[model samples]
Target chain A: MITKHLSEVTTKFNPFSKQAKTCRIFLATLPANARQTMKINSKVLPRDTDAKSELKIKFKDGREMQFDPDKHSIKDVAEEVDRHSRVLNRQAELAGS
Target chain B: MSPRLGICRDCLRKIRSPSSSTKRYLAAAAAATATTPAAPPSFEAQPPPIARFPRTQPPSHKPPEFRKSQLHRQYTSLLRSTPLLLLFQHSNLKSQEWVSIRRELSIALSKVDETYPQTPPLADSTKLQIIQAGIFESALRIAEYYKPPPPPSPGDSLATPSSSPESTNATPDPSNPIFTHALSRHAHDAVYKFKNAHPLTPLLSGPLAVLTFPTVSPPHLKAALSILAPDKQAGFPAPTRRASPGYYDGAVQAGVAKMMLLGARVEGRVLDQGGVQWVGGLEGMEGLRAQLVALLGAAGANLVGILEGAGRSVWLTMEGRRGLLEEEEKKE
Candidate 1:
């Protein structure tokens, strides 16, 4: 999921909604110590609330992306992260610490 | 030895035709035997059924050796045993984090147990278990919906084997209707129609863990809530650093942050997060009993006052009329 490039993640989802499954799985797939490196804000909407599930991510290179969890599957979210992360990787390699 | 061809004369032709009278006698004997019923084979009655499988180990629908089958058995037992349990969604938490969290949770729970020395210590019995959600859901369905009739008692079957003969069969077949254990095909079929329709279905998904209590003790629940979720508005405040310095350890804090409270199942009823908080907000069962008693007592008092008021009003009216009549008589 290229978690190294992520700086912040904000998510809001109704746990009762089936469409929020992608959001839940994405959160679960984060590295165990990801909290140490990145900022994470997850809001669990109450059961009766009919709110839309949102997942927003900020990359290390200042690229921000927002995804509608209802419309996006976990694979789509992961692929999007990887695509952006690969460009960041190329730039870092050329710069060479 | 016979002289001709070295063969005995008796061996070559031994049979002699029976006379008519002899044939008639033989036929009469055969008729007599056929007319009478055969004698009892054995004096002793049928022995108790030779059990094919051990009573403790009933045949299971799936291969019992598989992990999922074992988990199914385990979850069914867990659901049946625990009347009060809280569900959680645990993110990627390191083993060290889980260890510290468990340690802190136990420390908090034991403190609650100390306050009520009269009650059995609940901290030891309460468990935090990470579960396979799909297997768990099926187990929950079986525990909730599958109500097979009680198996026939051995004594009952022994006495009335003639009427209910299948109960006496000593074979371990999965299709046998006599076995009604949770892993039986009957139980699976009973819960199959309502797949994912359970009220707790949504919560059952994702990486799930359960905090189970031996009994629905509100004090323990409150303590657990404080240690695990720790929302002050919910009335579950985290322990102060001075009070529980270990709770402030880095690993414990990290683990606590990763685990989210989903909902609870209390006494066979599914509850949302709010409902779980409401339950934790209660005092113990004794407190609930006291509240009921107080409510009923107040209602009884009100009822008595209403009845008395009606009688007193009638009496006052009659007395006033009598006095008026007496005063008029005096004037007359």
Candidate 2:
């Protein structure tokens, strides 16, 4: 996952629900020092709730992306994040001396 | 008696002589010339049944020498022993971070112990351990699904002649129905069918660490939560810099930020983070018991009041009627 380009990451999921595995894995995929680099917020809902798992990411360029883990796998989520992160990387390269 | 190499002639002759038993047998055979030699002992006699394996060490389906097997055994015992366990997803915490976190947790728990001096101190018994997810899942299945038969009493023997034919078998076989140890083939076969049906299965994936409490002690739990996932709104605020400067250390703070409490298992029931916080918020067993006692006492008092009210109402009605009748008699 292109965590370097992300400014903040937020997730909410029920641990007992099957669909929530993607969100859990996504959180795990973040770099060990990702907390130092980005603002990470996660909330684990109660078991009785059937709420859909949600993942929201804010990129360095102020572009916000939202994903429902119920509809998307962790792979798709990562691919979407990387898609924007590549553009940001190119911009940084052009701006650098 | 002439001396020979290291011995006299008489000593050499004595050493060379056959025993008196051989001479007596020879004489007896000569005296009873027609006696037939006793029949040689029968080769068909069965030896007493003996167990091929030691009583304590049963053959396991997996190689017992391997680390996996030992871990499986350890996990199974851990699952059985701990009634209250918190599951955490730890992402790449440094060793020093773990050390500082542990030190702060002990300090907090010991403080709880001092506050609740009536109960036995459990600070030392609680531990945080990283686990192999797959092995731990397998052990959880075995612990949840497999119910081994109780061991035979000491007076009873597996090899007893009069026992069932299966028990009397002499070989130490893994497939034997009697071997029900956690690592035994029977346990594996019995627990294999469960698969991912367990409620805790989803949480078992990824790098997992468990904080196990020997008992469902709210004070200890509260202290742990205050350190691990401190939330001021949840009433588990993190220690301030003045109170616990070590908790404010860079390593400990970084580790705590990275770790998230996923769920909990309390008395064999799975609970999510919200439920875990609820448990941590509890006052204690004594407080719960006091609440229960107070409720029951209130109910009892209400029952007495209701019964007395009914009796008093009936007595008042009868007395009013009797007074009216007496007044009527006096008017007559």
Q: Say which candidate scores most in DockQ.
A: 1
Question: DockQ (Cα-based) per candidate?
Answer: 0.58, 0.48
**Candidate 1 chain A minimal-lDDT segment of 10 residues:** A14-23
Expressed as tens digits, the lDDT of each residue in B39-130 for candidate 2 is: 55694566565654565566678989999999999999999999999999888788988898888988999998998888888889999989
Q: Write the per-residue lDDT of candidate 2 for residues A7-68, one digit (tens) a residue.
A: 99999998788788888888888888888889999988878886767999998889999998
Write down the DockQ of candidate 2.
Answer: 0.48
lDDT of 1 at B281: 93
After superposing candidate 2, which stretches have Cα over 4 Å from the reference? Answer: B1-41, B44-56, B153-178, B286-332
User: Would you give me the overall lDDT of model 2?
Assistant: 0.86
